[model samples]
Target: MNPRHTALALAVVLLVAAVAPATAAAPVDEDAVGDLTVTTAPATASAAAAAEAATASDATDSLVAESDVAVFRLNASGVPAEADDDGTLLGDELTLTLRQTASSVGVNETAKTLDASADTEGVAVRTTESAVYVAVDIATTAFQQANGTGTADAGDSFTATATVTDAVTDGENVTRTANFGVVEPSVNFVGGVDEATAGGTVEFTAATLLAPGTSLTIALAPGEGESRTTTATVGTDGRATGELSVDGFDAGEEYTVRATAEGTDLNATVTGTIQAAATETPASTPTATETAEPTGTSTSGPGFGVVAALLALLGAAAVAGRRA
Candidate 1:
C-alpha cells in the first residue's frame, strides 16, 4: 500500500477501536440506569386560615362554582304585632335575626318589607290608637359577611315596638303615630276546682294580665288517665273556677291536673299544676234522728210540797164547821 494510504488506514483503525467497544457494550443495562426525576409534595396539611394567600408565578386560573355564599337564620326573640278592637289581630311572627350569611349578587335587591327584613326589620302592625308589643330576649344575632363587605351583627333591639293610631280623628288626618316595642310580663296559672263532686271544682290562677277586656282562655286538662277537658274563665283577681267533668280516672289513681294558657310574646304560656284527690267516700247515711221530748214539771216553789198538808187540814176544819 502506498504511504499516504497506509497513514489514513491507521487513523481509521484507531478511531474505530476507540468507538467499537463502547458501541458493542450490549445496549447498557437499561434497568440499572435509573431515570433522574424530581418530585415534591406536602406531608402535613396547612393550618386553616381566614384568608389564604399564595405567591406562585403561574397559578391555576379555574373556578369551581359551589353554592354561592350561604346564609342561615335564627330568631331568639318573638315577633311583634299591633291591631285594633275591630276584631283585628295584628302582629308579626318572623323574628329579625340572622344565623348565617353568604355572598349575594349585586346590591341587596329586596322588594317588599318582608324581603328586606329577612334579617333586618321584623313583622309589624299598625292600628288606629292601638299599640303592639313584642318580647324576644331569647333570640340571638350573629355577624355575617356579604362578599366580604356588608356585615350583619347584633344591634340594640331590646325595645322593638309597633303602634297604631287614628288615621283620621276629628277630621284631622294623622301621618303615623303608631309605635311598637318589646315587653315581658310575669306569667301565672292557677286552678284547683270549682265544685268537685268527683274531685270538686276547678280553680285557676293566672298572673300575666291581658289587655283590659281581654278574655283569657284557660284549659283544664284532665290529669293522666282523664278523658275530658274542663275549661274555666279567668276572673278579675286572676282566678278562675269551673265545674270539672270527672271521667276515665282510676278509683284510687289521683288525676294530674294542669291549667295552661296559650303562648304569647310577653311570656311563655302560663301554666298551673294540680292533682285530683282520690275519690272521697260520702259520710254514712244518718239514721232517723229524733229530737228528745221535754219533760213536764210543776212550776211552784217549795210551797207546792206544803200545799197537800194545808189541804187536808182545811178539809177537817170544814167538817167541824158543818157539825156545829
Candidate 2:
C-alpha cells in the first residue's frame, strides 16, 4: 500500500505540471495601424520672408540668399477606427514627434497628438482616424555657415518619427520614420552647352530664395587672361540672365563659366570651348545668254533694181504723152 500508491500519486502530479500553462516568453501580436511619410516643398512669399527675417538680421535688400524657403508635409494614414478589434487596431492615442538635426536647418523637436475630437485648423485630422495630414510652416534658419561647405550637405535633415501607443489594450507600440533635406543655394545653367560662339551669349538661371531683385554675378574666364564679368538681377522665377560677348576670345580656346549669388557663398562653375562664327556662302546669280543674229542675203539689192525699172517705164510714158 505504501510504494505502489506513492508512484501513482507522483505520476499524476507530473502529468498535471506538463499540461499547465507555461510562462515562457512569446512574441507580441501587435498590429501597425498607422503609417507616416514626410515630403518637402517650397514655402510661400510671406512665409519665406518671415523665415529669412527670423534667421538673419540683415536689411531687407541685404538678406541672405537661399534656394527657397522649405515647408515640410507630414502625412499619417492607415489609422484604424476606435471601435475596431485588437486584431486590426492594436494601438490608440497616436503621437507624432518631429526632430530636426544638424545646421540651423530643420525644425526643433515638436510633438503633437492625434484626436478626432480636436478639429484644429491647419492640422487636417480625419474624423474616422483614417488619415492625418499637417504642414509645418515653422520658420527655419537657412544659415549656410553650419556646413562651411557653402552648400546644404548631409548635415541638414529633418527626421520625423510617428509613434502609436496602445492605450486601450496596453499592448506594444509601433513607429514610422522619415527624413527631408534642406535646399542649398544654387545657380543652374538653363540650356547650358559645352561650346559657345566667340561673340554669342550664354544663359543661366539661379535659385530665387532671396528677394526678386537680388543681384547675381556671371563671369567667363579664359585659361590666361582677364575674366569677362556681368551682373544680372534675379527674376520672380529665380532666373538671372546676362549675355557676355566673346569678341576677343579666339576659337578653340577653353574657358570657365561661373555664376555666383551676390552676398552669398553659393556658386557654380562649368567649362566651355569658344567656337568660331559659322560662315555663310553667297548665292549664285543667273547669267544672261546672248543669241547670234541670223546670216542671210540682203533683199535691198533686188528691191532697188525693181524700183529703177518702174521709174524708167514711167519716164517713157510721160515723154510719149508730152510729144503727142
Candidate 3:
C-alpha cells in the first residue's frame, strides 16, 4: 500500500473509535454499573414552627419539630467503572429537583434544581418570595432540614426528583412526592351534660373528627368521692356516647369529667355540679287504748247522761215529800 493510503486508513479508524462510545447502545445489565434510590420524610402540621425554630435558635438541644426538616436521602451503589468511589459519575454531576405541586402560602411555583458535584452537596431553599440556592461541602449530612419556605404550611405539596447523569447508561433518576399539610388529631365533648345528680348516670358524647374508630376512656372524678370510669369507641360519625356513674357523690359537689382517646394525644374535659335528691319525713300515727269507767261516768250518748241526772233529782224530791 502507498504511504498516503496507509495514513488515511489510520485516520478513519481513529475517528470511528471516538464516535463509537457516544452512539453505542445502552448497557444490557444496567444494575452492574450502579443503582440509585431516594427516600423522603412525611409531612407534618408543625413544619413551619420547626423551620422557624431551627433558623432562630443555635442550641444543639433545641426542640426540632417534625415538620421543620422534611428530609430526603439519596443512596447510590455499584457506580460505573469510569466513576470514583465518591459517587462522582461521568461529569461528577448529581441533581435534585423540587417542584411545588400545591401551596397554602400562594400559587404554585416553578420547579427548582439543586446540583451536587465533587463531594459537595447543593441546597435550594425559598425562604420568602425570592429563591435562595447554596452548595455546601458535606457527605454525611446529605439531608439536613426541609429545603424551603414551602414547607412552612400544612397545605403544601411537592415532588422531588433525584437524578444523576452518565451513570450505568445516560441517566438514572428517582422521584418522591410529599405533602406538608397534616391533620392533627383532636378530641372534644359534643352536647355533654353540664350537671348530674348523685347516685345517677351522666351521659356524654365524645367527638374526634380526625380520628375515627379510636377508643375513648371516659372518667368522672368528684372532688370528694371515688372516680367513675367507662369506655366507648369512636364511630364513623366521629363520635362516641359514654356514661359514667355519679354514685357516692355528695350534693352540690363539683366534678371534672375527661375523655381521652387511646394511643393518641387527643383528649377533652368538662366540669359539672352534682345534685342530691331531697329526703322526706313520715308523720306519726296515734295508738288506741282502753280506759277505766270513772265514777258516775257513762259510755252512753250525752242525752242519756242528762236524762239520768234529771231522773235522780225527781226521785229525791218525791222522797222529801213522802217524809214531810
Q: Which candidate has the top score in TM-score?
A: 2
Which candidate leads the pack in lDDT?
A: 2
Give the TM-scores of the predictions, in the order they appear.
0.28, 0.38, 0.36
Candidate 1 differs from the real structure by a C-alpha RMSD in angstroms, to one decimal, of: 34.0
**Considering only N, C-alpha and C atoms within 3 Å, which residue pairs clash in candidate 3?**
34-78, 47-67, 69-146, 154-181
lDDT of 3 at 267: 57
lDDT of 3 at 143: 29
Number of clashes in model 3? 4
Residue lDDT tens for model 3, 1-324: 999999999999999988785544443233332222221111221222322322211211111112223333333333233444555442343455445443432544433222333343322221211111111211122322235422322243444454434434345442322222323445677674667877887888876643333467888887866777888876646678978877777789899988765434555778989977767779966544344444566638659878888999999999999999
Model 2 clash count equals: 0
Candidate 1: misplaced stretches above 4 Å? Answer: 1-187, 191-205, 210-227, 230-243, 248-252, 261-296, 300-324
lDDT of 1 by residue, 53-75 (tens): 11111111111001001111111
Tell me the tens digit of each residue's lDDT in model 2 across 224-311: 9999888988765556766777777888999888877644566688888888889999997655544544346333565876877798
Model with the higher lDDT, candidate 2 or 3:
2
What lDDT is reached at residue 35 by model 1?
18
Candidate 1 has what TM-score?
0.28
* lDDT of candidate model 1 versus the reference: 0.30
Quick one: ranking by lDDT, best first? 2, 3, 1
lDDT of each: 0.30, 0.50, 0.47
- Angstrom error of the Cα, residue 56, model 2: value is 20
